[model samples]
Target: MKASYSEFVELGGQRYHVRRWGNPQAPTLFMLHGWMDISATFQFVVDALAREWNIIAPDWPGFGLSAWSPGGYSLLQYTTDLDRLLDHYSPHAAVPIVAHSMGANISNIYISARPQRVSHFVNIEGYAPVPEFFEGSLGQVVGRWLDHIAKPGQGRPYADYARLCERLQQSNKRLPPERAKFLASQLGVMGDDGLVHIAADPLTRFFAPISLHREQLIELWRGMSLPVLCIRGGRSFISKAFEHRQEDLQERIAALPQGREALLEDGTHNLHHEHPEQVAQLIEALLEQ
Candidate 1:
């Protein structure tokens, strides 16, 4: 039987757009997506898995259908908000979590900090500077300015829905063409200023780059004490500056507690969207472990 999409409780006054599957009363599986990505990215994969496990996927607070937090949002904000989300929706019952990119980072911290609360952990392309960037005041100010400058050009504003979809497809080449266009429709609103984007407040791009204190988070990952499955999109843009140094990411992964790594053969950084069936297959294996 197919499940339906619905909105659940709002967080910090922001509405959380969520989609569910299977029996709400059944054992659950939680899916969290990457930055600028909506829960719909998991639609195909979750649809295939939902019959047996209740599945819940929500847009991150500042992105997707969820209302953006006032004055933009940050990593810490997402972490705190997600804690509330899990608490209200699945409190007292540990559920398996599958997350990609930013979702992976936050899930690692949350599950690690409170190990018993999570039944399993699946991190897809979630490696942050495994050792983390330095965090003195200089790093903060410099990082902030560099973040904005890195984009170089003001991002294009979609003149229409079709244009928006094209831009999205360009952002992540891994998405199936038709599906990419479909998702683009939900990501913006028609406005006099062109298709004023609806997802991720414009200023959100300025949020501080997180510098995880490795010693702290490594200890946290250890506490989570659960089997972790790490999947990397074979074509992940892990090395933005030097494509040749893609393997450099390993030093960081080696720093991870310990686990076998899997590669999604036909994927980019957003591997889940590119190869949902493979991601689902990998998760099934992790669940069994």
Candidate 2:
């Protein structure tokens, strides 16, 4: 395994934790993680690469070792944060982005909003937000927010590292024991009090009060100026809400100025981790195109 290093970068008054691997002079590849996941979650995938890439993976605010957002998180904030991240790293050129889940969602919008900032993107199992949530009544949304504000958030503590690993495995059945153990270490640290807990801010559990409409999001997809490769996991529940709307999802994907979608056999939502070699091959193909 290649040695990776961790460092902090102050962005917009918040300190971000970034994980890096490979040669700094190599072409930059931004690897973005899903909700509740840290930059190190891409370890297996990064290790399976065939060529060198200066991999820059940041633990998004409120996740991993990054500082929490004092004003709470919004989707727009993620896009701007990424914009600043790129400015600080690749100040003069567009770079490739490989993102999963929530990270993919943010990248999709970012590329749409600022097409010149990205050369291409590979989105894994980040089909689209559930239509229901996007269509929810404003009153209901506010009620949920009020409820969240009524109680202070708290992180769940684990008795030991092994216990946390077991829980991680239970949550993602496709995750092997060794990978789970590795991810457990990446997700949290053992506190001096002798308990293990997730590094993400507890308030991250709060739901967003508003979301883009279905067509509004599709417009963003349509505006993408770069080629995009969308990967789906055959057995992942991430697309469960789109089970009956596969056509809509495909249409949205097709709206990309240049887009291609593929589904991997026997892969789950975390397919990048479960079959990093295969995922790496797909990414290589995208790069070739």
Candidate 3:
């Protein structure tokens, strides 16, 4: 399959790498990948799309080919960087967004806080990283941060490129051998020792001190009047997590003025990767609507 090529751009005092497909003049569709995932992870989904679009997928700061923040990661920092990126790419109009996992979590908070920035949002297996998900108190959070800062950051090196691809497939049963190999090619780089290391900052493994309060996210949801399509993998752990708070999750989804939800019967957390054609069909319908 044909794939998008990458280019680097400086934003927010950091360099960001983006994978682009289709025509630049076409309507922009911003794609956000999950934690530890690079921009190229969306290649399959982009290929499956039936409509013409300018798909821009950027590697989050510290991930993929993007530069890392001098300071550690935080939701506010990530959201701020996203705002800067939008200001550069889609200044005048609200843009459509497709986000997965951590990317979805970041965009959810952003759109809710700045509803005027997004026209439509497709959240894939990511809702919000609300405080409810945190088991640590302020003291624990501080201790974790201290520990992380005290330790030297290091990326995990693989025995070889094939081993890296194999590891990816082993972790996600839904990921095919071919797709895993593609991702490995995009994400792995050769180290001086001839080992393959993931092309992302090791600092990303550090934990954030806090997350948005669940009530705050709910407030954003109340003001989110734009259309939303929330897709969940029937076999995804994220789906099960939401089920633990079914009443709250349903209420939030219900609050969207034009909200809808779907389930890929055989899908996992990486539904877009496993069922790109189906996801593309849904996206086409979403954009048309």
TM-score of each: 0.83, 0.95, 0.94
- Locate the minimum summed-lDDT window of 10 residues in model 2: 127-136
Tens-digit lDDT track for model 1 on 193-281? 65556566555556556546646655555555677888886666653422555455544445456456797756778776678778888
Please name the candidate that would achieve the greatest lDDT relative to the true structure: 2
Candidate number that wins on TM-score, 1 or 2: 2
User: How would you encode candidate 3's per-residue C-alpha lDDT over 171-269 as one tens digit per residue?
Assistant: 888788888898899889888999999987777877466766667776776777888888888887867777667888777778777888898978988
Indicate the TM-score of model 2: 0.95
Give the candidates in order of lDDT, highest first.
2, 3, 1
Q: How accurate is candidate 2 locally (lDDT)?
A: 0.84
Model 2 agreement with the true structure over 11-53: per-residue lDDT tens digits: 8887999999999999999999988888998989899889999
Enumerate residue pairs that collide in model 1: none
Q: Which pairs clash in model 2?
A: none
Error of 1 at 72 (Å): 3.3
C-alpha displacement of 108 in model 1, angstroms?
1.7
lDDT of each: 0.71, 0.84, 0.83
Better of 1 and 3 by TM-score: 3
Comparing candidate 1 with candidate 3, which one achieves the higher lDDT? Answer: 3
